[model samples]
Target: MNISNYIDYALLKPSATEHEIIELCHNAKENNFYSVCVNSSYVAVTKQLLVETDVKVCSVIGFPFGAMATKAKVYEAKLALENGADEIDMVINIGFLKSRNYVSVLRDISDVKSAIGDTPLKVTLEISELNKNEIIRACEICLDANANFIKTSTGFSKGGATLTAVKIIKKTIKNNAKIKASGGIRDYETAIKYIDAGADRIGTSSLIKSSTHAHQIRNTKIYRKYIETIQKTTDSAKPNNTIKEKEV
Candidate 1:
């Protein structure tokens, strides 16, 4: 199959430089990837780099962690759109979901979706941090929030997407929302498995090293970050039940 069409070529590392982002856009263009996913700061540059191509620019909101305030996420998502992001991938408020504060979790996602208008919003569940029931609950919540896609992970977590998790998400969301299987997907074989399981998009940077375009970025050694050094503190915070209006 045409794996590139399903790929969201990503580079969300906080340390990613402009040069790296430029290379990412070019690589994506060369491979004709569905989109180039980057941090909000790089959306403008990525948009510019891929302006002459059909590749879309995707920006991450609240990034690898979903602990930010709803207003802040809204602002970031808007700015990313202004800067030319075609889609938004937002991390869900894991703490709120874990604390069983479903209201806050629902509001957090819906608020962002509301702000983005028609832009496709992908809600990241960070499945590795959740149980099967939590995964189902998160997918249901995302559907309630009008999320366009239910993303599996942030890749900075302890683990990435698993086929089991994808199947669960597929079963949970059904035809309501699409699925994006991200994290830990390192090769064509692994990526295809997620697609077969029901993922409409594959968010990964690993293919950069294994694809035919490897020669394009081999010397820069830029693919190292794609493997992702799991963030130890990503899920360490205790579930806080307080639903403050301000940034958490």
Candidate 2:
């Protein structure tokens, strides 16, 4: 399976320097990974690096912690898009979700979605901070808010993506809201398991390949009901070839 299509080629480290960001974009360009998920500051450079390529630039909004004010998240998302971000991965307020104030969480996601317009929004649930019931409830709220994807973990928490958490998210989401299994994934082997377990995308940093557009995905086909905006998961629908690493 050419898993490169499923990978986001993540590099969300706080200590990442501008040089490293440039290198990250270079590496992403050299490989057919679906996108480069980076902090908002690097969106512009990454976008410039990835020009004329299918590899998209995904920016994190609200970031590892979702405690920022709703307006702040909206502004961040807007600015990221202005700087050339193709996707917005925003964190949900864990405290608000724990407080059973579901309305606030819903509005938080919806507000960002509105600000970004057609740029698909991924709601990071921080599955590590929530229990099964809470995860389900958070997924419901994201569904109500019309989020494009439900991501697991920020890799900043105690735990990262787990097959069990992916199962919970898969069971909870309505419509075609895709699932991005992020955090902890660093190899092709582990990433494969997440997809088999139902993840529509994989976020990682330690994986790479020689650049080739053989499996790159395009940004089209909105999967929403009333709103025809934002693209679907990076070619999640493409059939995985039986060709193995040895063959490649």
Q: What TM-score does model 2 achieve against the real structure?
A: 0.83
Model 2, 1-248: lDDT tens per residue? 77778878888889999888888888877777789999999999899989999999999999889999999999999999999999999999999999999989999999999999888899999988999999999999998898999999898999999999998889777446999998898766677789888899998778643223222311222224214322334356668877777764
Whole-model Cα lDDT of every candidate shown, in order: 0.90, 0.86
How accurate locally is residue 246 in candidate 1, as Cα lDDT from 0 to 100? 86
Q: Report the error of model 1 at residue 84, Å.
A: 0.2
Task: State the RMSD for candidate 1.
Answer: 18.6
- RMSD of every candidate to native, in Å, equals 18.6, 16.1
- Looking at model 2, which ten-residue stretch has the lowest summed lDDT? 213-222
Candidate 2 Cα deviation (angstroms), residue 114: 0.7
Cα lDDT for residue 75, candidate 1: 98
